[model samples]
Target: MKYVTRTCYLGQISILSVAITLTCVSPNVVSAATPTLGCDDSMKTAFKPDGNTTVLLVKKVKKDDPYPSPSKEQQIFPNRPARFAADLCWVKLLVGPGVPGPTGAPSTSRGIGIEVWLPEKNAWNHRVHALGGGGWANGYEETVVGRMSVGNGNLPAPRIAAEEGAVTATTDSGQQYAGASFAMNPDGTVNVAGWRDWSYRSLYEQAVKTKALATAYYGSPPNYSYFEGGSGGGRQALHVAQNLPEQYDGIVSIRAGASTTSDIAQLYPELLVLRDLGGKAPSREQLEAVSAAAVAACDIVAGQHLGFILDIRRCRYDPTKDAAVLCRSDGGTNGTPTCMTSAQALVMNKVWYGLTIDGSVPDPALDNGWDAPVTGVRIWYGYPRGGYIRSLQGDLTWPEMKSGGPDIIALALGNPKIGTPDFKNATANGEDGWKTLTYAELAAAYQSFRAMQSETGGDPDYNSDLTRLKISGAKLLQVNGLHDPSAWVQGLTEYYDRVMAKMGGPASVQAYYKMFVVPGMSHGYFSGAANPNANPPVPADGQLYRALVDWVEKGVSPDSMVFTSPAPGSESSVYKIYPHPHGPQMSLPACAYPTVATYFSGDIFKAQSYKCR
Candidate 1:
């Protein structure tokens, strides 16, 4: 919606005086400063718009300083051209060529100055739609626009323009800060203002504004609108669906968290555990041992020939008993494999479980690949202790490896917890309660990693508002990579369950939501032979993005999309897409809730390999 600036406190005048003055003023009196338009001339020109849909060319400002100043370090690789900085300014760009209509030529408009992406267009018979991306905290106006250009060669406004032959606008949440405000200091400390602006409020505000802008630009409200994002962006998709459902007709949240706090909190426990190990780096032996133990525990359940636990839901390890085997390897040289020590095992277990220190049992249905035992060669480990030493450069020195532990620990402690209701009661038994520590302790630790999280601003209880999102008629599609190493796939499932519970149950939530699990995809996208060391590859049958589009546009709800590995031939270029039934069944009916996929009959290598329920 178009924003109008109103002076809330002019020279500290009392509200009563302002109200009285307003009553006495003429109805036509105008006093606010005129809105500015256009960017500097030195930069590339993108279109800027006044509150109305009028378009003008504006110079772009770089999001950050061209070079690292004394306050900031230089970007490691500055390959991309610098961007325009539009902090607090209002700018607009023209997307797509104007088309002559019955009345006049129609042009699409978008806001560029603020962090959000807003697109709008006006045509009598046309419609308007807004798209949301993941990581609302991160500055994505450029990224989203760039990706759109690369993938579909149409900016959001133009894409929507082409799709519906209607006008459209998108936003980057009008935030000045990049997502969250917390940036690490040169010495690796958190920056505060950076943190607060980057919190959930930015994304929430973006969603709200998208609807407002739609109403303002179109004269009439959008007939139908959709929100889409994957991973962190997926979380934004869920947030809109859960918190502002009536605003949009469809939402595609691919791999979103149920609670932002819980998701972030879950990473710390493992980081803490790893830090306690006090090694320069886990020896090759240690990595192998932990990987091996993990596989043995859950690989069979994955029903894959690779012998790795492809999912996290099925992993079931008793920390007390599995702890020993988990850390059989500890300190060793780079060349030699070593057994994990007790302390090391504890850390690995915690990492596998996420940062949740509480006693809440993990959902049995989520097949976390943590339990897969490491039998094959270890590909790599996290940053070597001292600094980033490229693998191609050779093994890192012991002292260098050791240097990373403290920082890793600090990051673990300081990371923000994913906000979820389950976390509140995690440690109910006094000192032994599931979550045990107070919110203050967690906040302080999170400050150490990224100080912006300590601001305690934004809607911490946003996840609890799913009912409101549903009431608004939002549809959600959640996707996750089963083998995601960054955020556990289990966490995504946990978030989905929380939404279902908040809405009563699966059947009740079914009208608004759907979840899909990608077999071999990584955190971002499918990595293949071009990037062998990537975390996960899209299976032979996966077409995750296409599936999302189909669900959003064609009204064909995805039950299960197929995944296959690339064969050694030209035909291997083609993907095989399959559909699995939704809900529990005897023969691996992608079971719901507590039911897990377990082997019942037939050869494990075949699609008839196992059953879930």
Candidate 2:
């Protein structure tokens, strides 16, 4: 059959089509069937837009296909028929009968959420395009279609699918709890059922069902499949590439979290330290100032201070050496520019060290100012390291251990004798005395805090069986801002190293994965400097997404990408694209683990000024 190609332009919106034809005898071709509309009798309630609404489209399929039979590995239940759902602005297509629920009853089938963009007219040239990331729950089918629209306005999926002459879908990964943990839960008991359902199984099932639904709906399967996402969504993209390589021709995983479990565990130690150091809850302004000062002090070396610590690798601010700036005690009071106190520094030191009391410090060379000793000056610099400190009132004395609870107030004002020697030292060192408090105690305290803060569960290593991904020949790109204290860039680096190690070594893993470290970007693309006008709304502007698209479609890997703080009320911005580190031979070699960017020549502020080897 001949299909006409058409182009439609609506202001900034442009839809272009290329001519194509389809033969009737193609493998897996299906006759066009009209969509049936009926309310589920069991769920006999009027559909309301108040909560999320899902519409299921079912297509009968002949049994003779090459799709994988449900297996223990795939975790999919037996195949029933082809069924797909149309949610707001997206499609959830599935291929199986249904999986067993927590009660062992046949549960509603779960599948991937693919965005379908159809042109106004039917044509054989229709293709499939995959949209990528924005946290697990943030990116919606509507958001992606809107961005691709001509003038940055929302476009309905049906019109888009028709206009692009394509059917597209995204994977919600089964049970829809945002992250995997929530998806696997069925029981009130820590929601374990949702967690299991959401893992790799949901993703796999969605892929299979999406293809089936497309073929059933369009009378032909998708011509091509693509995957894209950043951060948590990036992790989902990696899952597809690894587990279902054949499901997609091109995969874009930007800033993907390869080892999310480890990342969460790592944050625990830091959180504990902050809690112990009297920094549980500081105002946003206080946190911002503290972060700014740390960036300033650590942005450069003594001779070449860059006024910003874009690259944590080059920062060498030793708390012992630059004591005034690194370990001040002003506590954001009395007009002090710093954000931390000595006690807080000790807590942060403990947190950054993973709460391990082995006394082995992180390599100072790679530590930046992150692992510096806690000092009073550093306390006023940012969020307190150990936790929040409460003001002592009226001859405070230590409360009994059991009665004191986990509150910082008891630690601050309770019996002085019960406290550690470092606490005493902090009180004695004039203003900076609190800096000497040992992090060891705080680390132990987290045992109780962990029990109190959240429910407990067994440590489940999601990456334990990454062999499927490895065999699938998926490529991964991970990027993190060096100055990001939220999920500290070091954690991402560490995760990459661990994944490589598990896969044998860099030689074995290099082809499948790579990581890029952005020097100056903050968490969610916030600004590193203190300028409010310069801060750009993060995860916007498609910087990370563009990088992934380039890598996947063009085979052009990004050694470095550019980032800049937007100028206030101006279209122009100061941007810089950092390059991969160069060796003495001037060869651009990938950075080895545990090392950061170092400047051998030029100005430290410029990315061209240094190399990471």
Candidate 3:
């Protein structure tokens, strides 16, 4: 929680800030030196593992090792591939084995598995960066641990950090073996220890141990630390900032995931709407068409037909009654193969408005109020109408269903643990789970999940106070793509607003934290035209990482971020789109919250043409 002071001076300060006064003296790190320690088995003894943490493995990855070290190198990464991580010492730990977590939680037979990759001695950057896992995955998927995984997931966070000369680590939070199944015991009891590990304990231990081991090797503690992640990983990043400020000096949380209750509540509405269709759901093309129509209707600025909508809230064209989308038989004029039927439009309408009874966000507010029945209650906000509805529509077909709505219901119903028969029996017949469930049952499950948010999901932790971080001299940079569907934009904005309320207001919060929204970007996945007429989706590059480093080091706050789409014939690489104003890039200006890149004049492809107003 300490920083190397540069200089602190006082002057006429606005009542809103002394927020700035404190921020001025904090620089990310001034390293002791690049420390080098031998990388080998002997280092295991040198680690001096403490508490219930046991160092299980320590090895060096020689330079030119195929990055990520896949089971089969060609399976995921092939050809010239990703940045080959070289010259590093890899370490793994079994943390808090058989340990009972907080709240008198029962002890687990297994311990949390954590992996750390530190650059070789002279290569060490004197900084520690931890990666967060997606979904139920922590960081590492190691067999040394007992429970495998809730979903056997891992992210590229640690690898990327090691590549950057950082001492990095990821904790599997004891989910490496059992995946999502770890939450439910064989006898159908909730695994409170496992839940605690995944949600809270694992990350805390990893930070303490990762730093301890780094100090062991480096002969000095790191001057600064950072954590960056997107999606579930993003949630972990926030968790550290909120619960363990001493862990990292800078946090870049992108498209952070919501609570389990929010996840179930937000997804159920779509499942319900589709289930009611009785196998008569709209085709993928129809869903895409309506999504396109929403963009087409909303992307206009002044006289210009801008590519993407700056503010979706202002774009009120509803598909259910829109003239351009409805088929002639149902009402309107469009005769294209993609025209929507009344039924299809109804589905879109439900998805847009979400499953709210009073048009409030469906996400449960943190309180005793959430323990009641979910009927006629707000669940969470709808997926904003964008991202080509690709992730959603592909999930529409029962045979190839991709959404986790049914599973969420199962998990939620188990409250405080995976309910025994319900987890298996409900989702047993696949989509039939959606067919047979009664509204009352669904509501009860939603209620159950909401109540369990503290133990299972990091809702209380993730959404709680940041006074610790704000005062820690740390900086926060959060980004969300305007077109992202995996994580809710409205939800993120609401979280920011909540933080603002907790920290006084936007001005006070902005002193040490900032958020940016990318236009035409979606979950860092697609990189082509989502709607050809609108700005195409593009990959999010590491430019934000540089911004975070500079912000933490030089106090240069980002007032605006530039988002880019590949221009025709542009070099087919990410860097061409990054570092700003590279060759033939079609980019847009992405401003800080409450401000959007408004088109002023000139070529739409030029970011300079738009101003943050």
Largest TM-score belongs to which candidate? 3
lDDT of 2 by residue, 210-268 (tens): 44445544555565555555455456665665555655555555445443323323333
- What C-alpha lDDT does candidate 2 achieve relative to the native structure? 0.37
Segments in model 2 whose C-alpha atoms lie over 4 Å from true places:
1-127, 131-167, 176-193, 216-220, 257-286, 301-307, 314-340, 351-474, 485-488, 502-508, 528-540, 543-553, 560-612
Estimate the overall C-alpha local distance difference test score of candidate 1.
Answer: 0.36
lDDT at position 107, candidate 1: 12
RMSD of each: 14.1, 16.3, 9.0
TM-score against truth, every candidate: 0.54, 0.56, 0.79
Winning model by lDDT:
3
* Model 1 CA lDDT for position 608: 60
lDDT of 1 at 87: 24
Q: Candidate 3, which segments miss by more than 4 Å at Cα?
A: 1-37, 67-83, 99-109, 143-162, 273-275, 357-377, 395-402, 415-434, 439-444, 454-457, 460-462, 525-529, 536-540, 567-585
- Indicate the residue-level lDDT of 552 in model 3: 87
Q: What is the C-alpha lDDT profile of model 3 across 1-613, one tens digit per residue? A: 3433332322222221212121122222215664434577776565554556677887766666655444211222244244345666777877655444333222234577888877777777778777666555442455221111111122254345445788777777666442344554444446656666676677777676777677767777777787766667677777777766655788877767655455555454445554656655566677667776777777676666555566665666666568788899889898999888777776665566555543233222221112322235655556565444533555423221234445556555543223322233212322334445554565566666666664344453336477877878888888777776666676677777788888888888888778877765665523312354443434344666667888888877766456666554433232211112123446777687857777788886678888987
lDDT, candidate 3, equals 0.58
Candidate 1 lDDT by residue in tens digits, 1-613: 1122221111121211222111110111112342222234421222222222223323232333331121000121133223322221223332221221222100111222222222323232333344444343334445322212111111233333333443334444433223232232222334322222233333433444333333433334445555555544555565556544544566665545333443334434333533454324455444544454555565454344334444444456433355444333433322324455555545544444433323122332342333322113211112111111111112422221112222222333432232111111111201212233432344344334332222322222235437665665556666565544433455456556667767788777766666656544444333211122212223332244345456656766555543443332223222121111111111222333334445667754444665545
